[model samples]
Target: MNRIGIPLRVGLVLVSLIWLVPYAWMVVTSVKTLPEIVAAPTAPLPAGLELGAYREVFESMPVARYFWNTTLVALGIAALQIALAVPAGYALAKLEFKGRALAFGLVLATLLVPAQVRFVPVFTLLADVGLTNTLSALILPFGVSALGTFLVRQALLSLPDSILEAARIDGASELRIVYSILPPLLVPTLVSLFLFSFVFHWNDYFWPLVMTTDDSVRTLPLGVALLREQGTGVRWHIVMAGNVLLSAPVLALFALAQKQLLNAVAASTS
Candidate 1:
């Protein structure tokens, strides 16, 4: 340990606690009865733990189906984004073509514009195509992500040209070089992209809200919101329980992949 390490560790601990407090509160609130929550909403310890909210969460909604639905949509979007993003990114990064700069500029420009602004047009498109209220509606609009393209392009930009040149000298086609050489080199970056897409689409509320009218293709976030909208009025405990369920997969993914995510992000930026 160094002289400043103690304070640094303390700072990190404080930050971690700051980040964790809300989640801890959610857990406490989820397990408490409404009366108990009302009595001492800020209490660190509940008088008694009730697993009832978890039960209600499952019973009041098709949470398991929503889980499956969300998982499928998120994975589908991530997969399609990767498939499109890589080639687009590689083209932007390496290939010299007409309007390349303009194309790249348009992609980066989308990052500045909020998705909400385009929702009306996209929703209308899906509606006209009769794809609304379907999983494809959830997946298609997000399948080609500008952020994913940007990140993969940034990662590709960080690569040395010699690697591609050597492959080219060995009589490999550009497609072959990209397919064979790029994938392994960009695996961590791709994983980072996958993590980003999965977390973002999994937690997205607006698109699901606008696209689907029924529970048949609803995702977890939509399911949670629906739990709050029932005629009986808001059930905070159940809502908190749904929230915990909503956050679990994201938390688990972060716990498992934080190392790779950080390393890949750092590499791309560097």
Candidate 2:
């Protein structure tokens, strides 16, 4: 068993390295001079490492504006999603009502429908409301999340019913029970949902691209796409640098929350 495990571990390590190769290459290429990048496109190491590409990227585009736009929009969407999803999830999990099953089924059915299929209608609605060319256009459409509602519902369902019943017996109103009892127990679920919402809104590009024509309202992903388009004849080093910069904060967020996310999953399952 030990001998077989040794080979299995070695193979897994090799596969992991293969998956990380592209990201490693992007970082190395971002620091390499144009000539060096062209000279050895497949080289594992950067030649004459420098920060010139990053400097060029910042100089050539409104990176700060893009960062701010992404941050504000993503944070707003995350806060709104959590606020809506938590109460709805708690109701679905705990409150008894006629048609509860039907309501939940309908919600689950929506998960089968791709958001792309609704894009045209959503765009038309935003345009009709005269929200086109504004940040509100980007933020409003994503204000509520069905996926968050479902995930939190599942997490809440996994909690002990006796605890909720005891709280109710102690003269706790439904709202108070949720605030005092459920909220503390559901921290793991909340953290997981927050991370999901943050990442989704942070990386969203298609809706932002379609809704806003103004450069001031563009997010990081759209900004990176614009950089590639406008930097014609320039080396791709700048583009890579922009991508690296755009991805850094998200990477940091995931790294910081990874432990909480895992614990949340474990707690829900337990």
lDDT of 2 by residue, 1-270 (tens): 556687799999999999888788779889988888788877778866799999988887788998999989999988888878878888898789999999888877877767678778988987898888888888887777777788779888888889888888998988787666776887867787777778878999888888888888888899887777884585778888988998888888878888875664564443
Q: After superposition, how far is residue 28 of candidate 2 from its true place, in Å?
A: 1.1
Tens-digit lDDT track for model 1 on 164-219?
A: 89999999997887677788999877888888788888889998998899889988
lDDT against true structure, model 2? 0.82
Q: List the residue pairs that clash in candidate 2.
A: none
> What is the TM-score of each predicted model, taking all chains together?
0.86, 0.87
Each candidate: how many clashes?
0, 0
Displacement of residue 92 (Cα, Å) in model 1 is 2.0
lDDT of 1 at 49: 80
